[model samples]
Target: MATPEAPLREILKSVSFTQFPLRVIEPFFVADKIVKPRLYIYPSFAVHKETMANDEKRPMLPTFDVKSLYMLTALKFAKYDFDIAYTSEPDASPDGSLPFLLLRDGTALDFKAIMSKLQQNSTELGCATEEQPDYISDVDGDLEMPKNELPSEPVYRTMVENNLLPVIEYLTWTDPVGRECIGEGKYLGSYPQIIRNMLSWIAATDTAHKLKLGLPEYGADAMVLDGEVLYENAFRTLDSLLVLLHTVDDSRLFLAGAPSLLDALVFACVNVFLYAPVKSPVRTALLKSDSTYKPVLEYAVRIFDQYFASA
Candidate 1:
């Protein structure tokens, strides 16, 4: 698979890791039944957790969105390895989105499709559900058996609507300070000033449009008064999720003990909330460790360490 001229890394502050932008790369296709996907993700940033980072060193940030986190984590659980490429223009994707999977069959799968593909191909690909790992048993292990099976769609709906979507929109679009950093590449850190500002506008407008559709409460007209409330809702939702995790005999650590799409969504939203590109009151609450959201902050760190693989 040959790549077009990738964006120069020398000017990119010498990224510790790099991914080929899809616009600049043509993926490989083969007749081989066994295939490894080429994963396209949002740009990688630096992970600096004042409360979460106990060590002196910081590691490169992984996939930027929750779905990407989920997809990568799900692949890890399925025991599949993939080639990764990062690009700021997820809009250029066939589906016009981020966190997509390009397979050897020349198939492009978005988040849900990626999950379906994993579960469908697990047997041929040799996943834990088919041919057990050295650990993570199928039927006998005490540890939660890691599989790619999905959770309830309603759970997905509730989380995204009340928890993830609003908060992401609030932070990325409605807030002015956050907008400045995004436009300036303080978060993505890969584009020219004009391109960065353009990407920021696209992301903000698209998310804001989604919020507008679910309007009245989230209407664009209400952005000034109600937008900040989205952060509060996100924090409370985190605490609620914590309660759900504690109360239910759900899967260990994650919603189902194994890495699934649901956890990916939750992790993406909460992770970005605590470590937004620009600091705000919501971030302050999580950072204080005295606030009610301290446990949720801790949970974010636990998942990051477990899945993101800190260097």
Candidate 2:
């Protein structure tokens, strides 16, 4: 009789990893089954503390990473079930990214693949159980947009994706104060001094390369990488979204009823800006001079209180 490991043996013959541990590679030779799907994500400071032994219980912590937060919100909206695993190592994922889903059958899924899978199985999935929290959207509830509104969804989504998301990334990764705040308060807090310093340097360099933000002047304190254009575009996008919020009737609870995927996306970005321990120019503008943007902020807050405020 042929075994599943036979093909794996042939495949591994040509693969070499001198530094990789044999214990890690040994799993590939076995056919153990994973019963529940698991979501691998960057560690959250609040979650880390909450799950610590003998620690007092606290309100469920919101996701610290933007991608993790939005993906989590979307999963909750879809009423999906999966276990959460906190990890700092992105190399464990097939695509070398955090927030990937490891399925029961050992298949890994990136964000787009996970969302596509949910859509394909929409009818079969999304049935909220008694154990599920009531704060989430009703699976049977209507979240469909009007026919005319449908066409505009993609446009607004693009505005948020292209403008708003980049600004968040710029602020969090490129801005000196923002990077320090998150690195100290969340991502690197648990690591020892030496390791933390090394990882922080690597993260900063990687982020600069990924976002194409030129480095600050050498030895210059309080200098920001050129983010003027990013901030300008972000404000324009915010103004446009705020105008749309004004046009909507007061009866609606969110930009869309029951909070569509776009709403979830917006909520994730805005909430981060509002609550991040960093000095966010966008957050300052929204709260100070641009009072017109308050409605959008209110919308994001409402979504948070409804779903993520508690576990």
Candidate 3:
């Protein structure tokens, strides 16, 4: 008798529990591929306004922002091609944060994720031009430094994020002068006055909570922030940064021979301290004659003039 034919369902079932595909597609997640990227940054103040002799108006100076400036610098340093769209709403991002990057394939990456993606150096990410070199040089051998050596780039980065960032927040949200300079109109300029005021109050409340200021205290109140402790920590952090800056060879623009992430961060912090319209004692300290922070002040100016001044 002819071999009994199996049921059609049985024939269609796999003979083996595991079967490998005959060919592998190059990229499994085609959606993750990046073409040109777009960066969404908070708008900066138009700090400088000038009228030309010919009755034409000159472009206003772009002010520095702690978050936006660093992200911008990092992308620029990577030689990445991108378009910048300024928005006041953080909720526009995938995770409700400002400074998120949008890849052409609709991928939204936060700051940490963006840095991680850049480090992957994937060709599909389109971070570099076809004709340009793909590798970014690490000027200092910090990556491979001995454990006991001066603090590495990672260490410095942590110090800035943890220590310096809070000070900036304190200044912007809790200081009277800073609040005035960063008026509600800066971000919510398009909204109606009533809505703007309401949103501003909500934002202030949220900031107060985040900054750990006690409830029932708001807007430049003594309970909002401890100026003594804040400035003390800032001074210590600045001193550490000054020491790090001194380690860089006089010839290089950044800690790394090339512009590294740390350079981006340092530039952002110092630039803001120097030129952001806020009345910060740190700015006074940096600019004072015979200031201990001369290198930092100079570094900020140099980076701005070289990279961001004309932008």
Model 2 pairs whose backbones collide: none
lDDT of 1 by residue, 1-311 (tens): 77656656654766644564535655687544524457787765454454343332544557556556656666655555566777766775667877787765566767766555544443433332334432211222222215634356347546665766666666656577767654345444567777777868787778768765335764655766566566666666767676766654333456655565456566666666555556666666666646676655565566678867642
Off by over 4 Å in 2: 1-35, 45-60, 118-124, 128-149, 190-192, 215-225, 288-290
For candidate 3, what is the lDDT?
0.65
lDDT by residue for model 3 (1-311), tens: 77758976787694664666757779655643444567889877655322122212323335335788788877777666677877877787877877888856576778776766554443322243556423123111111111223347778778887777777777776666665456454656677889877877777667667766654544655553465567778889889878777777533577766666777888888766655565477877887778898887777677777777679
**Model 1 CA lDDT for position 241:** 70
User: What is the C-alpha local distance difference test score of each model?
Assistant: 0.59, 0.66, 0.65
Q: Candidate 1 at residue 225, lDDT?
A: 55
- Residue lDDT tens for model 2, 174-197: 676766667544677678878877
In model 3, the worst 10-residue window by lDDT is 138-147
**Candidate 3 at residue 24, lDDT?**
73
Which candidate model has the greater lDDT, 1 or 2? 2
Better of 1 and 3 by TM-score: 3
| Per-candidate TM-score against the hidden true structure | 0.65, 0.68, 0.70
For all the candidates, what are their Cα RMSDs to the real structure? 14.9, 12.2, 10.6
